[model samples]
Target: MSLGTLGRYELIREIARSNDIVYEAWDPQLDRRVALKELRLPDGISDKDKHARKERFKREARAAGRLEHPNIVSIYEVGEENGRSYIVMEYLEGETLRQRMDREGKITPEDAVKIFDQVLDGLAFAHENGVVHRDIKPENIQLLPDGRVVITDFGIARLQFEPSITVDGQIFGTPSYMSPEQVVGRDVDPRTDVWSCGVVLYEMLSGQKPFTGDTVVTISHRILHAEPAEIDGVPWAIAHVVRKAISKDPDDRYSSAKELKAALNDALQGALTDSMGPPSPWGPPLDPYSAQSPYTYGTSQPPGTGAPSPPPPPGGYAPTGASPYGQPYGASFPPNMPMPPFPPGWVNPPKRPLLSPEASEFLLRTLIVVLIGGVLLATAVGTIAWLDRRSQEATAAKVDQALADEIAKVERLIPSDPLAAQQQLTELRRRAQSHATRERIERLLSRAYLERARRLLDAGTTDETLRQAAGLAQRAAEMAGEDGQATLDAGKLLYDIATRTTDPQDRFDRLTEASKALEVAFNSEGQVRSEAGTLLGNTCLQIALLFGDNKARSSLYLNRGIYYAEQVGNRKLADDLRSRL
Candidate 1:
């Protein structure tokens, strides 16, 4: 059904959503179509919830608007007409990855890898910009006719340094794709997206989902406690890489999307041999199961699939049918260069014989005799290598035991003697040899520092005490390693301590530090977002007032403060900040 016009755009049709409506609109200025998502709440929702939802929708627009990439959906503008809020974005005419999977089950490993490579590339860019896509699944992936893959739906994205829209203890994400931390109501970061990407990869390489159940609760349980079944008929190295990406512990997973992509590429290089040809680039003609030459949306489907293909869009553009890697379609291949699979039935002719049969046989016999001598000598060397390996293993075992004992001892001290725990953890961190051990130590230290800071802030409000607590809290935030509970707690403590200071210079310096810490906390899931935004806005305003001589700098601070106040729906604060202008 046609909805009313929103601004200059005419809404043509409404796309389906449970609690919202997205209209397919035509933009007269751009002379093209666009998608306009209206932030309308369903009936029966409380006024408080409706307000929160509107704020969240605005946040989605702001978060997505900051990103500019070929593989990411582009936001054109965000506006409100009367009381209705709407977001305008580039209209995409394509099928979702979920639709493609339903049409054709289980993509080839090589093609799946290509798709994953692009997904990770987009994710890497988003992470670099400090946005975390909390919900990533096949449904959120759109495949264009021109072989371009786009990630859609930033509705649940968390922007770094902005107070999170989601409330504490609220679980929001596709159940099957949710990371363990997410399933258990813990804070998320780039690693959370990495886990979801791994789930998508697993589904693409295999016909089945990594985690599935009849109910959301059941699915969440599996996500938290169960391991995915092994992917069969895929390269062992590639499988191993995916497994690591989906580890139960965030620390065990790839630290970032870039790291995961690198691991996947390395695994692919090791799994494929030269003779079998390089893996395909991200595009069409890679589908071997399709009758259609280039498998695309609205094209011919595989036989006996029963589902009918949708018609192509009007004035649909043809596939580029070219590699994105700066090469022509049929260029002479360079050695070790990864390329798409050759067209069906194409084969390379055998090379001409280098020598006569008798000559080759005689040369082979001579090589065998040399190889035998080499093997005898290698055996003697291997024995010595084996002894050294045994000795190293024994030493590693002892170090591991000692490290465990130290960790346990520090854990006991964190509650009553956090200062001592922090000191010991710092020392232990230096001696930690394993990645897991270092991660554990860092987490413990953040907690210890946070506890100590909290206690100090609770005990007194003296200038000296405030400074001491601020220092400890700052250290705790640094050690928390991004979007942890300790980081959020430390940020609040730092801000509280800074506000208690009476001296202007002291307050300015302390608030500056608190702002940095709170920026990170703002992007985490919690009920403190509104509180953080208020404090941040106030801090910026205070700083501006202290240095009112520089009009340009003051104006900048005032505008930023206003933006934050408005973001948290504090219209009074926003107006107050604006009155200064």
Candidate 2:
């Protein structure tokens, strides 16, 4: 059977081919280069298995499509036509971390921290949204040319969907990086990401994986019980963090990606600061960025062993005036030749004085006095400068404290009176002048409005109150600047407005605003796409559930909802909605 094209997408060069699927194609119509994965059905595979595989493929595509993060590869479309299944994903240009490690041996500690941070950030976002990335290994992580790190291959990721497929004791991850629990076929959580990250860190620093054996079972056993070798001679702080991350027990590891990221940041900071100091022979070797070339001033070697040959004496022979000890004759002699010393205290000649003794004494005293005065003046000036800086810091701190206090007060008042709280927040906004101060104030105000709006909607308050809340949320979104939290809060408020209303025109208008707000939130720096996707899907579902006639439109919304929900691993909700169909 001939496979028809998907929309305006055109098949491009095949970038990658695997046993299970072939990835190719780009969509110029959408201004995106996509990877089209066409699964190969093996001979003798039953129709039941084929249908399951197709559903699974579609589910994976939808789930991956919902995740919008710089560190996660995106899926654009998943469809089937004429017995062929296809999934379109973002075309990324970069070598896999596995390939990089193989080529570069070991990554520098600084680069390791940076790369791990990106991984953690992505994982943290996914974990928070209830998505569990079951398979995380070096091969799945792409290192982009611009130094960005992205995790790929969520084909076997766990999402919130029904009839959760269980391989029944089959291991899912690479043996080298798999957590002990994963190896034992036990349930896992965000900490699994932490454990895998530790393995990557260990490999990056040590130029070797933490665990290895002749067989997969041996490796699995080592992962379960063995302690990794001491990472001496490597960067210390990084080694420490990596050790904790790769702890055999999940409880011994970082509880979340955020915690791991913080640890990595601390390690990086310590490494940088330690590198700025004088080198110590007992400590780890200094980074290249530190003072002095390691090649020139490093630890001294033992006598006569591998020492550079002493430069040949000036003309390959000792100089005539040279002493037996290699010192030049007369080198220690005074510049001016002096007569042989006479008897002690013997007077030779008299010289005329330029000034009177009393005058000279007075001038010396004045010079000494002036030097003392200069020292005192310098000390006073330095003290004044330090005091001024301290004063400024104190003032900034006070302003920050005041703003925080007011924000807390407003937050506490949100559930009681949203408009009154908003009015108070507006006053706080007027008082904040500096960009930093205004940004903080606006974030708090946005959160307040969002919480109040959600609460009011849940309480079944007047539609007018909801409208006001939405307006407040929009205002907050405009003022939020780059804070992802504020943008998300505003989007949520707008979404609440859209869902709580029954009027078709009003609901449509609110949803349009909600979509725009969510789009803004999704595009904002540091914002995760999982939450936004869920909200978007829910909005679409609400529209269909409250207005649409046939099951077709509702099913479409449901399908999209399941896709996004699964992408982020909101399985319970996704399963429930899928069951409704």
Candidate 3:
């Protein structure tokens, strides 16, 4: 079908194309994209088949449109143009999990858990609204740059939506991830999605599909009767969760995504506690000195020693500057108590040596002579020392000022032209380093390198960019103290690499490094709480996304994001992400 325009949306790109129709299109007018599906009538095909296909498109669009979760990709307007069917949807920028896995092998446990949680959160939302995602697989999941997980192609399985598309008894969905009931064409429920999620998780963790065979017939048989190989090297809790999720009998598996999520959460909590130890205790300790009394003076006894005083004032009369009961000048006594002796070293000043008049006259004469001579010597030496110090200070100050100015310029240019900023920073570093300002120059240079690394990442290809970014970040981290912003930025850069990279092992290592850096940042006390929290959330998200079935880890990412946002006063962003859940 040719859609000249769908509302305000101008067709920008063709997304999905098949022999029967152009399945998806990008729309610009409504700022929303749509799927344009053509209905092709072949010779000998009955009119009933044509009507059924159209009806199926409408049904699927309607069902999927009702879903309202951040992670569930939404379908907007549905209509027909030029005898073809179409449905509009929100535009997405990320590749499918299938593409990612295909490119990078298995996902890390962190990435798996994060992506799985997003899928499950979307599925759970759908199930609560009485909708089931029959085809839940990696291809239907998208990982957005803003760290969002989007589940797509909902309610669009060909057989389920259109009876005429396939025979009733024929199986649908990606064979390896399909549940037994789905393969056998039995009535299914939300557990079907849970089972599919399990398969996806297993594939993510193991880098291989749970059930595989050379023939469809054998694969179907395996789905019906075979047990998947034990998921070795994965967290035991996660393996257990996947096993239950993919159980042959629907009753043996989690009843819903919510149940599966709970189990995952438990596992994540256990893992975090086991790995990080318990949280610190709250509030301050009791003071030990608040109750102590002041020491007495004339009596010569400490207040807390409980020693008896020698006696009261000799005449029972107050001395000069003493109160009526013989308290020291301006002293306030506790009610019902007689004043004690003033403590030693309290009221009286220390005595000084007495000089004879004649000796004092001679000393003054000698002091005047010595002072004049000493002044002359001191002035000469002080002048030279001051000049030398001033020269060094001026040089140091000039280097510092130049470095600071260059750093500011580079920082301002980073978001616009990272390469230019990097070059400029390198020049500034060279200038500073020539002046023997290694520490200061290295820091600025490292920051510039980090910016370049980030830009490289945006340009594409994870490996080279990630490695470069990580190297620069680590250099910055090592040069700067643990709690310094440079170190934190380094950790965050490494984390971005881990999260964006497709390689499971690389992702794991990157995340591990990032986590350690974040820990250092948290412990630094000088680190911004909000930045630390955000990095922690990002780290957890990567970990969970890699792990697959651990919903708790994913939730922790969400929670940490919220916490850090609150700490940093960016609660709106946190709320937006959490709203998807």
Candidate 4:
């Protein structure tokens, strides 16, 4: 049977179907061929829920579509009807990494390195665009006939710059390559993608996966506790990259994808011959199914060797979503995170219903108790519940306030004692009581990093150091999110890095990130707004000049920047911005 049309595309045939259906379709509007992905959804959902999901799907699709990189598949459109949603994207002639692995077993180290580099380049670009492919597995990575790799399927991709909150304890991604934090249900960031990439690297280099078990429980246990099996003949630099990328603690991993790729390049170029050492390891070696790592919060292992010294206390980190708790259904508390304030011998809280709907109704219907008795009982119950809620709120407020105070201390120390502030913030994060608190702490810590990056850029003369500073600023920007003061500061720092860097493409990418950050900061006043406007305008001018592909789009940015400069009463900057326009 012929597949029907979805929106304006004629679905020629069903290409594939799993959780979603893919149809090779013709886009009449564009006179082009496109792959249509149809995601199935259950009926009977609330309209609100359905609408929210569709919006999220479209937003993610739009974000992915905006990315223009050689190794990324292009997205065109998204639509939803009835209970199904569809996305139109560029159709490619190639196989997935899973198919390649199945046919060839494992890849050669040389080919693997090249493939890894290409993937990282795409990922680095995506990260720059504030996009994170939460799921980066072999099956999701497509390979072209010419040996070019394209990162596809941004279904679960999240915008890194958007503030995300967790309402339902939910997490996503495949189990086999899940990072340790992912296994335990901790909040994830781009570094989580770094961990998954390490798993891919290991699998490509060695025919077998790093961790395995008979069941999801066992697999999760291994992922949390087991060290990756060593691959013989791995040069020190390659080994170093692998080790650092897969580090159990996110803190131990490279700060950014650019840094990870830099490590790979340094190893490939023999720059690491004089300085190849251990990094964060699969927390001390354990039996593959042991379910526990040797290192604990008290351990003092070397950096990257195992869980390092706990960093400073928590700050203003917060993320909100229905994002899964980083763990699977049966998984337990993740390693490295601070345990809740349970009593020494506390077991699981007893599951008991406080008040079922039936009881309330029965009470209402009971006659004699209805008058004075019902009134008294209802008042008592309501008062008790209110007191309990107020008490809980008060306690949480105190904890959050304390965390805020600690973060303020870190901020004070950033300019004068960055390392100490960093160390202190790291420790505080471990102590942070909730996911939102941890996210806030991460953002505050990134600011401390920004402060250090500024100093390094000011003082350093080495390309490596400059890159490192850029990486730090990126971490700050990614964690602090896409708006307000931190992002603006990060934009300025990235702008500085761009001016200093000589590589044309890298310079362009950095400038692009800078402009994005500055645009978000355009609403502010004083030097920041003026600086952001001028920088954004200049950056846009450079992108348009160098790329020359989308002058119209570039003109949009140039105009906005000029307007921002004019708003700030900076006539000189406004005039300069107009030159770009």
lDDT scores in order = 0.78, 0.70, 0.66, 0.72
lDDT of 4: 0.72
Report the number of the highest-TM-score candidate: 1
Model 1 residue 514 CA deviation in Å: 57
Over 1-581, each residue of candidate 2 has an lDDT whose tens digit, in order, gives 00124444545345676645645554545645567887777886999877766666766676567789888888777776667778777778889999999999988888888888898888888887777787788988999999889998877676654456666776677789888888878877888878988898888888998999998867875776556776655556667678788776677778999999998898789777874444432233323222432433453543224434435445554335545685443234323435342222122122223335676567558757988999999999989989997887778767766777877788678677867887888898787645567676667677666766667567765778777766766676666666665666776877767767767777866665665566555554433566876776676567557545657546755775676567667787688668866
On lDDT, the leading prediction is 1
Cα lDDT tens digits, model 1, 443-518, are 8998898899889878988888888887888788778776545556776777677778888778866666666666
Worst 10 residues of 1 by lDDT: 343-352
Give the alpha carbon lDDT tens digit for every residue of 276-335 in model 3.
333322112212222332422344444435543345555753434545576454344444
Q: After superposition, how far is residue 530 of candidate 2 from its true place, in Å?
A: 52
lDDT digits (tens) for residues 321-430 of candidate 4: 43366635433433465554322111222112223457634634563466679789899999999999788777766777778887777878877988798899999888
Indicate the TM-score of model 4. Answer: 0.46
Off by over 4 Å in 1: 274-581
Better of 1 and 4 by TM-score: 1
Off by more than 4 A, model 4: 43-56, 81-84, 163-166, 271-581
Q: Looking at candidate 3, what is the lDDT of residue 519?
A: 55
